[model samples]
Target: MNKNGNIGVTSENIFPIIKKFLYSDHEIFLRELVSNAVDATQKLKTLASVGEFKGDLGDLTVHVKFDENTITISDRGIGMTAEEIDKYINQIAFSGAEEFVEKYKNDAAAIIGHFGLGFYSSFMVSKKVEIVTKSYKDAPAVKWSCDGTPTYTLEETEKADRGTDIILYIDDENKDFLNQQKIQELLTKYCRFLPVPIAFGKKQEWKDGKYVDTDEDNIINDTTPAWVRKPSELKDEDYIKFYHELYPMADDPLFWIHLNVDYPFHLTGILYFPRIKSNIDLHRNKIQLYCNQVFVTDSVEGIVPEFLTLLHGVIDSPDIPLNV
Candidate 1:
């Protein structure tokens, strides 16, 4: 079946709000898309663990690829059916750009992504966006596409895999995202410790004064980071190694704290205090926040106590609701 309709929102004013508000930090689109992919992959793992999914869980990794015109983020995770698309995409039940603007019109700082507007953030850089998806169920696959407008198209599509691919046709203004070096840097900063492996093109080597791709995949995340594991299972050297992994060029941390609380809210991470004889302000906001391993932001003033922002480390918790 094929379908076309306007996205069910009260206002067409949402697009302008997203472009104007999110323009200052539009690079976060990559993080939001990749984080959604990780969430899907992790959900599949959870289903498999609970004996709900009987099929083989294959290489559950996310891939980001770009050509001249489009950038595609693909994942071997639980995908959405056509109806799912209608519910999640076409419908606007949850809080969104419209509500966001209305609620925080007076206070700009209060304007964070509390609404589930992360997917819409693609409009900050893309002229058109597409989602090609095949659910793990036996249902048929589908493709949903939209310009930076209220109307969108949904149609049946043939897909050989059970996953989703978010394709963004880059706009003229956001051409910097097409560069390989720039994409690599963004991935490193935003998704280095994601739970699922993320592959961006292939391993490259310098040959004949130019970089060439190798046969191996250029996987970019640490699936089993130190923070996500049990403290008893790791040794002292493992902690040091993980610290260096997070901050490669910095001096060694003076000491560290392993947080693994699972009661009221599931929070697990490692806090490292570096030696600071002077310049205390320089070390503030070094802690990176993650939700189930996908990097949220280094500005973690909301989740952790205000005092803890002085420490440097990784804090990952699915419980903490992020505005971004």
Candidate 2:
């Protein structure tokens, strides 16, 4: 049996493994983490609809704020309690967080929550991480703070809201997360259609000679995306319109498949077959994967059949693993 409150069985060796072998695309770490936040927020909405919680649903937004020293991802969602954290964060075995990190530490894109290790990927970019969260239940808010080492401290905190605020103390090596442009790019790439609104910064308008902040929050996502809606309610033009929303520069898609299965597993979305222009590899990443409209990966080859990856537009399937 593993020790309680321990980070990982093979914690020390995992970072090196991630840096060397796991993800071919290191920049994708930002996408994965933000998507996970979006998924959590959407799940809360679903729960609320079923009368799980009667609390007021505030602005369901995922805010990405970055400064010189840290990058913070805050979300209004269903947060984990201490016991949930112990089950999800502390234990490590074959399919545990430690083993997953060691196996995919190098591949940043590979460090998704396939083995339920999505939250821990924060360690890859930060020297220290703090999770300030309050569960939807009437429990007191808690702050779970951890450094890169195996030790962590979870204590009660004063959070007025019911959500999570993940603060990543940007490490000396991974300071790129602190860059405003870089963070914005990741948000646009990974979180354009999340069920809840995601805000990266203030809405800017060209004023006088420079960009000036507007009263509007710069929302980065479409809370109610087309994929989440019933196909009967949508027309061919609606699907075409959404396709252009995804690929502005590209030509119209050939045909589309509206996937809305909820029996064996929950899945929904519109997969459009774009016009392939000879170079299949160039168009390989055009198909975007979303868990409840929160973008998870553009590389959807593994989750969808290999043939489906050639298509463009969105595939919003909660059944698919975040890592895939």
Candidate 3:
């Protein structure tokens, strides 16, 4: 049955507020959406690990693609039911503006919208947003769409995949997001070390005087990064290889330290003392931050001690509440 209803919002101006105030930058919408996909993929992994889902854990890759009118981010992860769409998408769960601000006050990338605003962040760049999803359970697929307003339409749909696809109808103001180069740059910046592989399109090659896509999908993320594995599993060359993955253009580090502690909060990573050629202050953002191997941000002054930001490396931990 098709359903139509108004999204539960305090005021009609809520969409504008989300566009202007909820996120500091429009590019952050990409990170929030991709992170949500990663969360879904991770949840499926957990379920399969516990033997709750007796299905093959197929290639759990998140994909980002765009055409002339829309940009679609699809993931082979656990999807939601129609009722879940009503609860999570149509409802505004946060109490008020004060509580929202207070909750994310310290987070620079803004907390993962735990208050339920992350999905809506798409409005900052899209005129209309669509979600076509099929749950792993034996439930009917669903399609939910909203056009930059409090009203939304929901209905049953046919989907062969067992995951979610978030489609954003690009707006004129945010047309830059439709560019392949821009999209690649954003993916590299925000999702280089994500736990799940992310494919933007396909690997391209020069053929017949034109660039053509090869058979391989252009997977953008490193699902198993150096920080997530044990120190014993990695040799000096392996560490160096991972370093080049993180910093492709930088020189090899002089020495590196591996941190693995699980007491108060889980933390594991490799810290490298790079050959600094410039002022110490210039190398502050050498370290990248990750939560459960999802690339959070390069700005780690808030998490890493100020004095320690001079070094180059990656830190992955679930304990650190990354606002990004």
For each candidate in the order shown, give its overall lDDT on alpha carbons.
Answer: 0.85, 0.73, 0.83
CA displacement after TM-score superposition, residue 186 of candidate 2 (Å): 0.9
Candidate 2, 177: how far from true, in Å? 1.9
TM-score of 3: 0.91
- Residue pairs in collision within model 3: none
lDDT, candidate 1, 23-93, per-residue tens: 87788889889988988998989998998888999898799999999999999889999989998888764
* Superior candidate under lDDT, 2 versus 3: 3
TM-score per candidate, in order? 0.91, 0.81, 0.91
* Per-residue lDDT of candidate 3, residues 100-192 (tens digit): 555655553463445557788889899999999999888999999999888899999999979999999988988888899999998988887
The top-ranked prediction according to lDDT is 1
lDDT score, candidate 3, position 163: 95
Superposed Cα deviation of residue 244, candidate 2 (Å): 1.5
TM-score for model 2? 0.81
Question: What is the clash count of model 2?
Answer: 7
Per-residue accuracy of model 2 over 1-324 as CA lDDT, tens digit each: 112255655555554454444435556666656776776787898998999978888888788888899888888889877766667666654454465655665555545565555666676677788888888877778777777666778778789888888888888877766888888887787777766677888999999999999988898777777888888899999888888888777777788998888788887878887776768546644777776565666765566787666667776766766665
